[model samples]
Target: MKKRLPLIFTSVLSLSVLLAGCGTTAKTGSTATPTTQATAAATTAATPAPKKDAEPFTVSLRHIQIGDAQKFRKAILDDVVKKTEGEIPGLKFELDGVEDQVNRFTKLPAEMAANNPPKIFDLFGGTGDALKFAKAGRLLDLTPIITELGIKDKFVNLSQFSLDGKVYGLPIGGSSEGFYYNVPMFEKYGIKPPTTWDELTAAAETLKKNGITPIAMGSKGAWVPNMLVNTLMGRYAGPDIVNQIPAGTKKWSDPEVVAALTTFQDWEKKGYFTKGELGLEYPDMLNQFVTGKAGMMFDGSWRSSVFKDPAQAKDLTNKVSYIALPGVANGKGDQTAINGNYSNGYGFSSSLKDNELKAVKAFIKNLYNEDMQVRGLLEDNLLPSMKLSDAAVGKVTDPIVKQVLESYKKAGSVFSHFDSTVPSDVYKETESQLQKLIAGKATPQEMADAIQKVQDAAIAKK
Candidate 1:
C-alpha cells in the first residue's frame, strides 16, 4: 500500500579508472642518469591503479521515498550504499527514486516487458505486483539464497512473495491496520478499548454524548474509508475468505459480506465519524485524531511515524495505542487476523545470475540486520520483515510502536488489502462504490452486485 510509483529509467552507469601512462620518457641521445630508480618510483606513484577486468556491475534500484520513508532510506538504504563503499569491488548502485506512487503499479511492468528490468527494484508484495512478475518469469527466484541467508525463518508472510516452492522477493517493510485511539481521551471518558460490536457502539455513543468525534475519517480519496470497511469485512468473513472470491467460490453478495457493509452503514447512521467526511482530506482526518479531537482513527501502521513526531502530535507521547476493530456478534473471521501483509519490497530482476547474484545476496544480508530493524521500528514506523531478537525487541523505544509490533506478533494471521491483489478495474470500482455506500447513495446489495459484475467479467476474460 505504501509503495509509490515513479518515472521509469534504466540504471546503467559504468565507471572504470582512466589508465595513466607511465611517466618514464626515454631520451634518444641524452640520458638522465639512465632513468634513475627514484624517477621510476615517482612515475609509479603518479600512475592510477589498474582497472578491474570485470565491468562494474550496476544493481539498479527503484523505490519511492516519500514522507518518513526518506528517513528510512537515509538511515538504511543510503547507509547501505555508504557502508559498502569500496567494500565490494566493482559493485555499484543506481537507486532511482520516485516521489509518489503514480506509475509503480501500471508502468513498472512495461519496463519488464521490454526485457530491460532493473537488476533490483521495488515490488509490492501481493498477487497483483510481485506474484505477477514472478509468474511472468521476470523476477529472480531467491530460493537458493533464501535458505542460505536464513531469511526464510527471519521473515513473516514470506509466502505472499513466493510462488510454488520458491521465493521471489522480501518485504523489508510490513504494515497492518487497526484503530489508533487516543489513550488520554479514552481514560478521560471512562471508556475502554472495545473488543466486541456492542462495546464499540456503546463507546461511540459515550464519546458522542461528550461532544467528541468518535472516529476521524475522510473519504475524498475513497481508500481511507475502504481500508476500514475491509477491516470490517475481515471481521465478518474469515481472514482468508476473500481468496474464495478469486476462486469463484464466493460472491460479494454473500450474506456475511453484506452484513459487514451493513455494519459500516449502521455505524455511519449512528454518527460515529466526523461530519462532512466525504469532503475532508485524509491528512486532515489523521491530523484530527492525532491532535485529540476524535477518539480514534482506523488507519494503517504507517501512521506511527506521524504520531511519533512531537511537533505533529504533542498529546501523543505514550498516549496512543493500536488495537484491532471489534469483532462482530456472530462473525466467522479470526478476530486477531486484521488487515495486513508484507505490502512492498525489493525483488531481483531475472537477469542477475551466478556470481552477480552473490553480490546481491551479500547486500541484502547486510541490509536487513539488527540496526535496520531498529530504525524501521522506532524512527520510520515500519515493521521489519525479519524477527527481532528479545534484546533487539527490547530496544524498540516508542511505546505506541512497541504495542503495534506486539499486536503483529500475536495476530493469528493477516490478509492482503482487498484492492491490492485484485485487478485494477475491479479495485477502482470497489473503492468508488464504497464511497457511495457510505454516502447512502448505494445499498450494500447494489454495491455487491456491481462488484460481482466486474469480477465475473474479469474471470470470463481470463
Candidate 2:
C-alpha cells in the first residue's frame, strides 16, 4: 500500500493583544496665574496620549512542543508568544499543541485539504509538506516577508522551504542524528565511545550480556526507529542516495539500501534494541536511557536539552554524551558524512485577513531574530537555522552541545534525512515497511522493493 502525506503546513508563531485608550479633557478658559498655567501646560505635554481601542482577534497556531521532553522548547515559544502579542494590538493567539507525529501526519493534512488550515501552524519542508501545500496554493508565500525583515541571507539553507523563486516555511533550527550514551554506564562497563563498526557492536554485545538494553528505541511511531535506519542507509548506500531515489537515478531496492535494512534487522534478531520497542512511544525511549535502563540511544541533537535540565532528566543530568555513529566496515561514499536536517518549521495560511497577516508578520519578527535563535541554542539545545556570529556560537558551554558541534565539525560531509528528500508516498512506505521488517513479517529485500515501487509510482505522477 502506498502512503500519502495529507498534512500540509506547520505554523511557527502566535500571539494575542488588545489595547484601549482613555483620556480626560481640560476646561476651556481656566482662570490661573501665568506660573500655574505654564506648569499645567508642561504636565499636559509630558503625558503620553492614550492608544486607540482595537478589536480583539485570534490567530490560530498549531505546535508540537508537547511533553516533558519538549518543555524547554515550549518555554522559548511561550516567551516569543508573549512578546509578539505585546507588539501586535488586539491580536490573540489560539495555540493548539499536538504531538509531533499527530500534527504532521493527521490534523494538519485534513485541515489543508479542507482549505481551512490555522492562520499559522507547524510545518515540515519537502515535496510532501510545504512544497505540496505551495503547489495547492494553500500556504502563504514568505519571500517578501523575509526580505523585508532583512533576514533573507541569514539562513544557512532555505532550499527545503523554497520552491522556484518563492519561500513558504521557515525552519526553526537545525539538528543532526547520532548516538547519545550514558557516560557513567559506559565507564562502568569499560566501554569507550566507538569509532568503528566493530567497536560499536562489541559495546552493544557487552551491554546486552550485562542485561542492559544496548540501544533504547521506540517504534510505535515508526519515525523513531527510522532515524537509525536512515543513518544506516546513508552509510551503506551513500548520502546521495536520498536525492537519487527521488530523481529516478536510483531505486530504494538497490542492494546497498536493502543491506542497510538488513543491518537493522540483524540488530533486532540479536536483541540489541529495547525489547517490545514496537509497542513503546518516543518518550519511553528517552525514559529508558535517562533512567539507566539502556546504555545508548540513537537520537537527534535536540535531545541534549533533556539531559541539561535536571527537572526532566533527573539523575541523568550531566551524565550523557553524544557522538556520531561510527564508520561501517563496508560503508561506501563519504563514510564520515552525518545526517543534518533543517526541514522542520512554521508556515502560515494564504487565506489570512489583513489583521491576521499583520499578526503573522509580527510573530515572525519576534520569533526568528537573533535573541530567540540564541535562546533556542542555549535553552533547548537546538542548533540555529540562521547564521550565528562567532561570538554567539562561542556562548555554548554545555558538554553535550559541544560534542554535537564537534561531531558536525569533524564530519566529512552532511546528508539530509530521506523523509525530507523523498516524496511522502515513498517516505511513508519506508516507515510502515520498517515496522514490518522489525516484526519479522517482511524481509529486508521485501521492504526495499515495496518502498521502491511506491517511489516509482510517485515519480511517474510527478
Candidate 3:
C-alpha cells in the first residue's frame, strides 16, 4: 500500500522552533524577569498547536481486488467508511475502485511518487513490497501516532508488522494455513485427519489406490505450492529453524529442510497431487476442491469463507474440516506454530499533515471498533484483528468461521506466510525453484543451495 506523505514544511518549521528553543534557553539567566518570560513564551510558542475543529481531509481509497466482489465492494468498504464518518465526525473516504493485484503490485509505487497518489491503498500479503516502500522512506512511521491514539496495545502479535523493531503497518486480520479435507469423503474411505507424517502418507496412498486425487493444488500461481512447502518446513524444522533461514541465521541445506523437501518429492511420486496441477490455474484448482473432485486441499482459513456458501461451493460446504498440517518425527514445533500471516492494514505517508494523520488514526480506530469487528467476521466472513469479547461470532453463520476462530485462539505462534516474508523479487524464484525440486528437476541439496544463494544476497544487502 502507498502511504501519503505528510505536509513537510509545517512539521519542519515546528521542529526547528523546538530545537532552537532548547539550544538558547540555558544561556538566558533565570534571574532576569524579561529573559524568563521570553524563555517561557518561546517554549509555549514552540509547541505545535493542535487543530481545533478543523475540517477533516478527504482520503481517496483503493483496495486490492477482493475475491468476493459482491461482499467486499458492496458491503465491507461502505460499512467501514460509514463507521469512520461517525467516529471521526467530518472525515470522508472516496472509493477509487479496486486495483487488480498485478497492477497494484507494479503500479502503486510509482503512483505514490506522483503528486496525486491515493490517500490509502491495499497491499497484498507476503510480497514484502510494503517493507521495500517503507525502506525507501515512502511509508510513514505510524508507531508514535498509533501509541498516541491508544490502539497500539489492541494489536495482537505485533511482530507481524515489526521490521527491525519498527512498525510500518498494522495487521487488520489474520488466518491460519492447514489441510482442508472432505468430511464425507474421509468417512466414506475410512480416512481421518492425519496426525503424523506416516499417517498422512498412508492416507494419500489409500486415495491414490482408490483413484482419487489425494491433494488438490494450484501451482499456476506458484505460491500455492510454497504454502504447503512452508507448512512442511514448519513441521519438520520447527518454526524457529524455518524462520531463521529466512532471517539469514540458518542455512537452507539443514538436514531437516532436506528431509522435508525429500518428503514433498516422494509425495509427488506417490500421486498425491492433482493431475496436471502444474498446468491448472488457481481458479480451476479452487473449483476442483469446491466441486468435491479432490479429496483434500492445502489452504488457509480464508478458504473457509470461499467454501462456506452452498451456492458457491455446493459439494464442499458443510463437508469441509481443517486440521493442523501433519508432523514428522523430531518435528519440534507445536501444532499452534502453524503457517499464518497478518491481514493487510493501512500505512500512512510521512508527509501527511498532522490533521491528516489524526484523521487517519481516528478512521482506523472506528474501522476496528467493536461493532465493525463483529460485522467484519459475521457479515463479511472476514476475520478481525481485534480480540473479540465473545467467540459466538454473531451473524457469521458459517461453521467454518467459528472453527477458524477457535483454531486461532488456541494457536501458539504464527509464522509469516512463505511469499509474504521473502523479498518481492525472490518470491517467484522461491516458488519456481520449489516446484522444480518437487518435479525431480532439482535435488533437495540443489534447491537448498539455490535458496541459500538468494538468502545470502538478501542478507548482504541488509
Candidate 4:
C-alpha cells in the first residue's frame, strides 16, 4: 500500500487501452510466433548458446509468499503453472521465492533490475512502485497485447491501477481491514458485535469484566499500530481526511487526528490489548486469536482466507465472524467507510524479449479467465478482479468476505492508509511516534506535533 510517484506513459496509444473492461477475454489468434527467419537466424546463430533455448523461452516469476507455501503449492501455484503452460504452448515458468512482505518492498526492486531479472514479479503493497517502474521504462506496455487478446475488460478497478489514464498493472483481488470475533465467545457472554464507538468500548469493557482480552494486536511490526490509527481516523474524520493529509490540504495535527490518538491511548490504558503485545510478533498474536486465547482480532481480509482453509485453520473457521469497525455514533463519517485496497497482481517488464512478451500476455489472460477466477475465489477465498456471477461466490463461507464485498458495494469512496501514502521517512517516524504514544511515553499532543512537523517538512521538500 506504499505510495510511489505517478507513472507517465511513453506513448499514449501504447498503454491507454489496458484500462478497459473487467471481463473481456484475451485474443490468442493474433499473438506472434517465435521463429527464426534469415535475419533473425543470423543474429541468433551468433548469440551465446547459454542464452538460447530450442523453443519459446521460459519466464521466471518471483512470487510473494505470505503464509505456508506448501499448503497452497498444489491448490494455487501448481494450477497456475499448468494453466500458464497450456495458454503459452512452448513457454515454461521458473519460480522464485519472496519470503515475506518486507522482502517484496526492499529486496524485490533491486533484484528486478539485475541482469537476467525475473520476467514476472508479484507486486505487494500497491501498484505505485510498479507504476514508477513502468514510467522508468522498466515495465512492458501491456496495453497492446491485452487489447489484441480482447481481455482488456477482464480486470477490475482498472482506474486505480492507471497513471495519467494509462494502466501499468493488473489488480488480482481486493481486501479490507476489520474486526474478526469469536461467535461462540460472543454467544457465551451474551455480547453482540459492536456497531458504534460507544458499543465498541462497552464490548471491550464487558470482555475485561469477564476476564477476556478485548483485542489481540501485534505492535512489533509498527504497521499494525498504523492500521489501528487509520481505522480510527476513518471512523472519526471520514475517508476524505486521509486524502487531504497526503495532498497537503490538511495537517496531521488536526483535532480529529488528536481525538483518534486519544481514543487509542485511552483503550491501551484500559487494557484493551493483550498484555505484552508490544513484544509479540505478528504470527504469535494471530495464533493467540486463532487458538481461542483472545476474543477478537483487527486484521485484513487475507486473514479471513486463513480461517476458511480447513487444512490451515480448521478450529477457527466455524467459530469466526466479522463486522465492520464500529462507527462514531451520529458522526460525520459513514458506517461503510472501510479501509481497503487491491491485492498483489501481475506486471510485465518492458525489457522482455518479443517471445517472452507474448507468453506473458497469454499467461495473464489465461489466469484471469472466468474459470480460473471462479476457482481462485472458491478455493483461495480471493475475490477475483474479473467479473463473476453471484453463483461463483456462493461457496465462500467466510463471513469477512461477504462483509467486505458489501462494504465495497456501499463505499461512497475509499482512501489509502497513512503509512501507505506518506513518504517512507515520514511513515517510519509516524510509526515510531505512534508506538511511543501507545506505550504511554508520549502525550497525544506531542504525537500530533511530531506528525505535523514531519508533514510540514515533507510539504517543504515539494
Name the candidate that leads on TM-score.
Answer: 2
Residue 301, model 4, lDDT: 67
lDDT (CA) for every model shown? 0.76, 0.90, 0.70, 0.71
Scored by lDDT, model 4 comes in at 0.71
TM-scores for candidates 1 onward, in order: 0.80, 0.89, 0.77, 0.80
Q: In candidate 4, what residue range of length 10 has the lowest lDDT sum?
A: 30-39
Error of 2 at 213 (Å): 1.0
| Per-residue lDDT value at 454 in model 1 | 91
The sequence of per-residue lDDT tens digits that candidate 3 reaches over residues 1-462 is 234345675676577677666655444554444345666888999999887784756776766534652344247667667877777656777776554545445667677556345666665434366677666776667787678767777765556456666776776676677888888888899996787777787778777788888899878667778778888888777777645776877777888888878778877887788877888866687787877678888886766766656676786667888777755777766755766667466655656766667667766666656677676676556677766675545556767777766666777876766666667655656776877876678988898878878878877887
The clash count of every prediction, one per candidate, is 3, 13, 9, 11
Judging by lDDT against the true structure, name the best candidate. 2
The list of candidate 1 runs beyond 4 A from truth reads: 1-59, 68-74, 89-94, 113-119, 148-150, 352-359, 406-413
Candidate 4 C-alpha error for residue 77, in Å: 3.2
The per-residue C-alpha lDDT of model 2 at residue 457 equals 92
CA displacement after TM-score superposition, residue 433 of candidate 2 (Å): 0.7
Q: Kindly report which residue stretches of model 3 are placed more than 4 angstroms away from their true locations once superposed.
A: 1-58, 69-74, 83-105, 109-117, 124-127, 163-166, 333-336, 353-359, 391-398, 406-412, 438-440
Q: Report the error of model 3 at residue 449, Å.
A: 1.3
Per-candidate RMSD, Å: 12.1, 14.3, 14.9, 17.1
